[model samples]
Target: MMKLDPTNLHRIDEGPPSKLQRLIRRSRRRRPSTDATSRMAARLASAGVFAAEAPTSSGGPALLDGVRAGGATLRRLAFGVGGGALALVALGAAWSAWQERPADRMSDAVVAPTTADRTGPSALGTTAAVDSAAVPQPLSTIVPVVSVDELPSTRPGLVATSSTRTEVRSSSPPAPRRSESEFAIIKRAQDAVLSSPAQALDLAEQHARAFPTGELVQEREVVAVEALARLGRKAEAKSRANALLTRYPRTPYVVRLERALGEPLSPAPSTSGR
Candidate 1:
């Protein structure tokens, strides 16, 4: 058992209370102890220099982000590039289409050489504008091609001569065989058929000699038959018409040949003569 002192009961000890003043820290600005200075400092390990730059920041901000951020940037760039390429492709296609169009080609009509010289970009623009503004003409009215000599002379002294003859020739155009078209030979014959039947027959004979089985063989036969009838050779015309009808049962030349001969190639369906 511990005994209590009679004097300590009144007081814990003999010492009075001391004042609690704030004590300034001695090592705030001072160097550490001798033992601490002697010991090795906590330092980062020397990294192996694989490249000039480290994974983390060196002195400045880090450039290439890790996989996720880099991939995101790359994706954005790829999308942008792809979009640009698509735009370029569409633009190029449109340009090619515009260039290939036949309507964009210069008109076949002979444009009289303009008095003013057209040299610059402005000339192209002006020409396009004029073409756009010009009203379209029908194929029959619109001359496809004309030479300078064939066109009427606007110059004072140059007289427009009647000798400037124009010729247009047609046939049921099949595939052309030669450079000199079958139309050329038949055209002359067709024109002369009305006025000069003898001449037309001569031309037809020429055509037969040149193109034995021509594309315009039907037209040639029709012309020959007409010429024969016009020249007062009914027997020859009838014989030729019969032969032609036999060869081509549905020959379109029947109407013209029948009219010229003033009779049917095949005998007319005999009416009810009862």
Candidate 2:
């Protein structure tokens, strides 16, 4: 026998093998022995796992329907699990993006405001305090002020002399009065002279007897003369009137005497010297 090199085993193909090795290689190709996978299938068949002839209930049409339904159910379950896994992955990515946005916004909020505040530190304390003006009051009318001394009742008083707030007396004392009895008797006869001359003459005579030298005696005589003329006693009226004129030539009863006498009395002689 010749020795072969161990390091160069591929060179063995260069030499021809004996006849038995040739026969073994040819038989390996002709009728091959069982492989690892085929032997495992054979063992499972012997254990009756793949035996189709085992004696049990034979469901022909119903068994075929059950097999078809079970295959469709398993396919739907696989599709559902695949879709759910895809949805969960998408949701996780979106949640990570959403969580990052608020941090970015907070950083922007902290940094953006200082750039807009361009006014200096001098902007705060530049203004001074101020006071407001008072409201105006309403105007009133002017009242003339008068002095207390101006009132004759206040002997010695201040002389207030402005048109402000003054008060004064606006009235005076009344005139002196006359006697009622003596004046009234002659007055009644005077009022009655033309209407009731008879009553008037009687009242006149009563007055003369009562007040012979009364202050209103001239008026009484004038009333009596007018009463006499009214009673158609012209002669008596002329006589009393002449007596009246002779007593006081300047008597104010001259007009009454003339009216009763139905003629004018002669004017009194001139009292002034030439």
Candidate 3:
């Protein structure tokens, strides 16, 4: 056995640390290294970050501004189109209102003629110096010029003026009409026009002389024209037809008369040769 020493014996008493204490020292030693490596990695990650991976703090405001601008532009476009449509509607309404104005319609309405337009100049202006003789009498009051046989009988009677005195008066009856009614005459002439042309012509002439202003004057003229044509009086027929054309250009008889006159004449066969 070796000789025992005091220093060696103290060193053995404080021999190598225990396993738990060694582990604690080792963890303490590794803590500063791990902290420094983590800080370095954080700085590197922040500094060397890619532009695509970078975060923008101001991006929220810029996106909101773009959206607001787009909305404002759309709002302005919508307002512009809506305003144009409203303006067109207003213009059309104004035009319709103007066209239907009552004053304008009243201006176009027909007005009746005044009494001055109907009355002649003599009846209107100079009534002061006008004579009763010159004043035209009504046609109903005028006694037509007729023969003595056509006139009615006259009766003479005495009319008392005051009770004591008597005045002699004569009352003549209404005159008898010699001319036939215009309608009857025109009908008779029309009935006789084709069958008895000479009699129709004579009746028509008589009607013209008797009732010059008759309502059936045109009918009488038509009957006369047909009768003259049937009687082979082409010259008189053509003359009367021309007069009818001048008077009643749009008459239905005009077409008939024109057709009759325009008929082609047939050629007569030679009697001596045949």
Best candidate (score: TM-score): 1
Candidate 2, lDDT over the whole model: 0.45
| Top lDDT model | 2
Across 41-124, the per-residue lDDT of candidate 3 in tens digits comes to: 222221222112334446532222322332233223223332221111122112233244444222211110121123322211
**Count of steric clashes across candidates, in order:** 0, 0, 0
Q: Show pairs that collide, candidate 3.
A: none
lDDT of 1 by residue, 1-274 (tens): 8578776553322235423211223323465421122111100000011112334555331112221232232223223332221211112113333234434222311121131113211211223322321323233544444456446567565343332222311222222322333444565676578779899899999888878876557667777998899899988987887777777777655766787688766643232111
Q: Would you estimate the TM-scores of all the predictions?
A: 0.35, 0.32, 0.32
Candidate 3, poorest ten consecutive residues by summed lDDT: 107-116
Better of 1 and 2 by lDDT: 2
Over 4 Å off in model 1, which ranges?
Answer: 1-106, 109-179, 267-274
Alpha-carbon lDDT of model 1: 0.44
